[model samples]
Target: MAVPVVTGRHARLVRVTHALTTLCFLALVITGAEIIISHPRFYWGEVGNVNTPSLFDIPIPASRPWVNTGYGFVMPDQNGWSRSLHFQMAWLLVFTAFIYGTWGLRTGHFQRIASYYNTAQRRTYLLVIFALMPFMIWTGLAMSPAIVGTFPFLVTLLGGHQSARTLHFFTTLALLLFIAGHVVMVIRTGFRSNVRAITVGGDTQA
Candidate 1:
């Protein structure tokens, strides 16, 4: 007799990581948007600043008056605290991912996902884990003053600090969209049942 396979459930460890990722990502997005308000201009190449010719700029007023937002007023500057929170949350997210990725590989959890997810879900997971995250980390570090100071090549590889910042903005947008779509998926698939299945590990009701 063949062994039976159980789907519609998640391991305890998986659920824990999922929850942590959600919290960390939420903080990151909030802080990221707050940081963006300080300066909305974007540029390319080895250098860019308030005086440099911007490739483009958001029409809204900047939180910092030093930034030429073409508006007379400035928004309240939240850049200081937001940047601190963003940096801290980003590391938490990275650590959680590292643990999950290592465990998934060691236990063949990635391969086992085929039993639970359809092609689209698998593709989304793979793309997020393998591509978007690494790219985001790279670009994020590229924008950091200390990181770039120590590893100048990091920024050089991405072209410049401003380039990294631009890419990071777009990447954040992509992550937000992914989260939105994921919520829609959960709702469509049966919100309460799916939530229970993931949290408590059991087959969900249709």
Candidate 2:
């Protein structure tokens, strides 16, 4: 049987959404790493007393002489602009995810992506998406004292900010893994075909 192809306006929209999301994720990864390492300490294990630099080597912005980023019980100082950037990136991510998720549901992106897969494949796809993505965003937010403080119940649910930080790290790791798997799947599904679909509406224009 001939293989099905992605074509037309919908495919173009999907491609654009994918591109934007990819960029957002990459930016967040870099900024998030810098934010996490600003203190040179971690909630999990001994991150050690090492001085870790920002991921992009970009200097933290100048912001009010740098205050301590209050992570519940732990407060780290001289984080420079890492805090601001982190919060900015967090907002951007949340917005991007909201738009992408809404579009996905409205456009049937999820269904179309999984329609070709078997039950097992579909399960993995949904799990990575529904379970992992939401968890990452949630845990990331929970790390903020302001957020946790506002919703005291979050501290209980997350077992404190320290625990939230730990969960955030793992969630980021999971996102990375999901991105890798997604890229691989895209390639396997026919890179050229997919690219065309995304760029020019399937291969119709090709």
Identify the leading candidate in terms of lDDT: 1
Candidate 2 lDDT for residue 201: 62
Writing each residue's lDDT as its tens digit, candidate 2 over 1-68 gives: 12234533345445666676667778778767666555434553212222432222223332222423
The lDDT for every candidate, in the order shown, is: 0.83, 0.62
Residue 153 deviation, candidate 1, in Å? 3.1
Give me the runs in candidate 2 sitting further than 4 Å from their true place.
Answer: 1-10, 44-82, 204-206
TM-score for candidate 2, please give it: 0.67
Best by TM-score: 1
| Per-residue lDDT value at 27 in model 1 | 89
| Model 1 TM | 0.89
TM-scores, one per candidate: 0.89, 0.67
Model 2: residue 54 alpha-carbon error in angstroms: 21
lDDT of 2: 0.62
Residue 13's lDDT in candidate 1: 74
